[model samples]
Every structure is written in structure tokens, then in C-alpha cells.
Target: MTKTVAHIEKVLEVANSTSAAALSRLAASWRRSAERHGLDPGEHRGPRRLEGTHLCERLGAFEKLMTVAAPRLDNLYSLVGQSGCAVLLTDDDGVVLDQRISAADTAVFEAWGLCVGADWSERHEGTNGIGTCLAEQRRVIIHRDEHFYARNTAMSCIDAPIYGAEGQIMAALDVSSARADQTEAFNRLIGAQVAQTARAIEEANFRAAFEKARIVVAESDDAEAATLLAVDDHDLIIGATREARRVFGFDPLGALAPRPANDVLGRADGPTGFEKAERAAVIRALTRAGGNVSEAARQLGIGRATLYRRMKRLGLDQT
Candidate 1:
């Protein structure tokens, strides 16, 4: 095994019997190294579009908005520091558009295949910050136990969706990480920032869909127009806003779990737009893990060998 992987394994050794906080020291060490060399996760990807010359037509507007949002996001991401904070932006289809992250969490992010060009639609990718936020159509802050991918269980993720002018689901925003200083307050703050960013984009378009999913309300610089609603499958709405009731066609009483972007719009049995090769790969990963590699894997399934292979293939940190 490479030295880095060996080191991470050692931490896992202690972690096997220690608290989740035990991983902080290793994260701190990796953070220092990643800072000097830089580990830019997430691939800067283009939107998924229908075939034809109209591709630009589908992407141009969102692209412009993301470009504008990027700088402010950069400012926001700076607050993340080395706290294992990772920020990601995705279109309604769950294709990642942009992302930013802290150095401490770089190794883990890359290991999970979070590059910009990656596709995270629910079926293929399982449940995660980006996918769950998009699928559930509500802001979610998942820490540990909530992860869908067994290998990802160790992570703490907070994801919020963005919206366009008419309230269409434009995209989703997510922050995933594992480290010290991870708290509910921190999660709420990030969720709120993402919500504001979504609303800013929404003012520009109304046909937005998942962009409206799970969008948290940004801090009220003035009298904010956004609202936060909780919904499940029933479309019953609950929570803080006239905007939420108006935007999502929610019932006043029922609620299940609404991941709007992840809604099964097509065939229920088979995979959806984002489900394909990734699903097969995840299955293979589970099978290969033999169910013993938590840190090396995601929620649970991770073997030293599998982790090494994935790291090599995905160009993740050797350590």
C-alpha cells in the first residue's frame, strides 16, 4: 500500500474503537499537505442537454448564472476553512456544475468520486448530500447515519437546492465533509447561504424546478422573499413560508419525504436519467467490499484493496 493509504489505515485502526472525532488528527495532517499541493476535487461540468444545436440554449442561461454565483460562493467557501467543508452546485438533473472545498477533506472527496463532471442522480449514485437534496426537494443536512452509500456513512453532508425565476428546480447545492467543528449551527449557516444563492438565481427565472428543491433561506439582508417548506411524497407542506406554499404545489397537511429533483418521473422499476454505470459500479463495490471497509468505502462496504483500486482509478490521494 502507498504511504498515505497506510497512514489513513492507521487512523482507521484507532477509529475502529474511537469516536468519530478521532479522525480529526488525520484530517489535519492531510489538510496541511493538500494545502501545499492543492487537491481540487469536483470537475467543472456542463449541463446535461438534449442532443442538437440547442444544447447551448439549454445551458447558456444557467451557465451564466453559475458563473456569477461562483465568486460569491468562493467568498462563502472561504469561511469553510479546513473544517472538511465541501460545496457543490448541481443542475436539476443532478449533474454537478461546480464545487469548492477545504483542503482537509480533499482526500476523502476525491475518493468518493466527487469531481465536477460527475453525475449524481439518485438511482445511480444512491443517497448523498447532492442527490438526496435534489431528490427530496428539501434542504438536508446529513451527518453520518443518514448516508445512502454504505461507504459514505462516515461523512457529514448538508445539501440545499437552488431555484430559477418561476420556481423550477434549477439546481442543488451541497456541502459534504468529515472533520472537527462539524455542528448543527455550521450546517444551518451553509444551508442558509445556499438558499440565498438559489433565490438570487430564481429572481432571474421562474421555470426553475429542483433549483427550488430544498433551498434554504439566505440570511435576510433585507426583507427576504424566500421560504422553507418540508415535504414528503404526499406534497403536503409544512414550515416557514408563504413562498414555500406558493412555489411547491404542496398540500397544507400531508408530508412524506420530497426530493423533487429525484422524483421518479419515468419508469419506476428501472434506473432514471442518472442511474446507469454508476449503479453497476456501486453494486460491484459492495460485493467486493465483503462488508468490512467502512472508512475505506462509503456507508459501510470498503476493503483495503477496493479502496486502493478506487483511489488509483479516480486519481485520489495516494495516502
Candidate 2:
């Protein structure tokens, strides 16, 4: 056996044994995948690619996601490029939607089959970054020889999962490098960056999905870590980011139900906060009720005259 494969076999032996002392969580995942999928660490498997109609259909289904994620992917690339890495965006199914590879490193990346429309699911690509992150539904760093397959030992990978407004995983953002060997500190740094970028993408997606709702950005010590809540015209929470749900101590499933925004966010202490929130709520009500003044009034639990007065005061009458 080759040296690399021999090393992998020994690692697997340790992983499969009863003693889990030396096995990292990721290594344990590799073992679980081996048992579940009957994977062979010794063999190199090329990533599967969807072709022709299948490829087109997959792309079509993910068109909206691509549109929302492209700019964020570009930004992530700029941040990680200095470290000789590229960014990849993939759908929940592990079908790559898009990639950003530096022109100088195109050949190196292409050789590993990191390209648009390629399937990188765990079933197809073994224990690589993108696939494993989706399988585990968490952030991961697969550095060098940590990869299950011997052939993938040369590259280092970091990936983070992006959750949808409904709390389901929507995609994975991966940053990978083959230029230089990666250290644990560097992996952690890049992993954090990847996760932050993924959260930004999720926030964008949340806003896009609730474009007409009043977006409530909750107060946070870390602006990047703030939670986003979408409140309808009746001041009821319609949707929220996963972080928002967690930070605000909300039940994940209960976030779907329409609850008073003030009940969750707490009423503003002064007139300024109250008036702004009230005006925003009125506008949202009008929007959700489709500009029907009577419907809007009903939703706001106010008479038509009151609704009209609020609109006039808020300068929404001009629109």
C-alpha cells in the first residue's frame, strides 16, 4: 500500500476501535461515513457532474439562490484570496451552484473538479469539505490529510452551512486551498470567516424573501452577529434569521406563528421608538393587505379614519 493510504488505514483502525481517545469529531464522522456508505479510503473518486437536462434543471431550481448569493460569494473570495484560496457555493443537495477561483489558480482548482454544476455530495465525493459540511450540518475544517480519500490529502478545506429563514439548511459556503500547507490556527481563522460570510448570505436571503415586511434588526454588541426579524404590518413577527431566533430566546418552530413584535422585542421606552415602530407597522399592514385601506385598517385593528390619519402623519399618503 502507498504511504498515504497506509496512514489512512491506521487512522480508520483507531477510529473503528472502542477507544475514541485520539479520534477527533471529524475523524469520527469519517468512520461513520465509511460504515454507512461502504466507502473505500484507498480509492480515489472523482466528483460526479450533472449534465445536459439534469444540470439545467438543477440550475433552474437554484437560480434565485444564485442571484442572491453571487455578490456575497465574490466578497468572500476577495477576503480569502490573499490566502491562496477560492470560494464555492453549493445547494443543500451538494450540487455546486457557483464558484470563484482566481485566474492564476484555475488549473489547480479545475484539476480537483471544483466547478459550477458539479455534484459534491458525500455519496459522490467522499469526505471533502463541502460534502462533509452538508452531511454534518455544521462548520468544518478539513486540513490536508484529514480528508478521508488519499487523493484529496493535498488540499485544505473550510466550510459553513447557511440556514434558510425557516431554519432548514439552504446551502454551504466553502473555502479551499491547495497552494500551501494549512495549520490549525489558519484553519480556525478561515473557518470563522467562512461562517460569517455564510451568515451574511443568509441575512440577504431572509430580507429578499420578506421584501415587503418591516425588517427588524435587533440590537447586538456585534453588528455582524445581530439577529434579523421580519415583522408584518400588524406588528407580528413573520420570519427571522436562525441567529435572531436563538439570540432573542425564541422557539425555532414558534417563530412561524404571528406574534406581536413588541411582545418579543419589548415595547420602546419612549415616544420616538414607539412612533417609528407604529408607523412602520402601519406601512407593513398596508403592504400586506395589498393597499386596501379597509383591509389594512382591519389588520391594524383600527378604524379607516385612524388608519388614514396615521398614513397622513407618516407621509405614506403621497405614495
Candidate-wise lDDT, in order = 0.52, 0.78
Error of 2 at 208 (Å): 0.0
Off by over 4 Å in 2: 21-23, 219-226, 247-255, 264-319
RMSD, candidate 2, Å: 6.4
Evaluated against the true structure, the overall lDDT of model 1 is 0.52
Clashes of 1: 49
Looking at model 1, residue 11 earns an lDDT score of: 38
What tens-digit string does per-residue lDDT give for candidate 1 at 63-107? Answer: 866766677567667766456677777778776667796666677
Error at 264, model 2, angstroms: 4.1
- In Å, residue 7's CA in model 1 sits off its true spot by 24
> Which 10-residue span in candidate 2 carries the lowest summed lDDT?
266-275
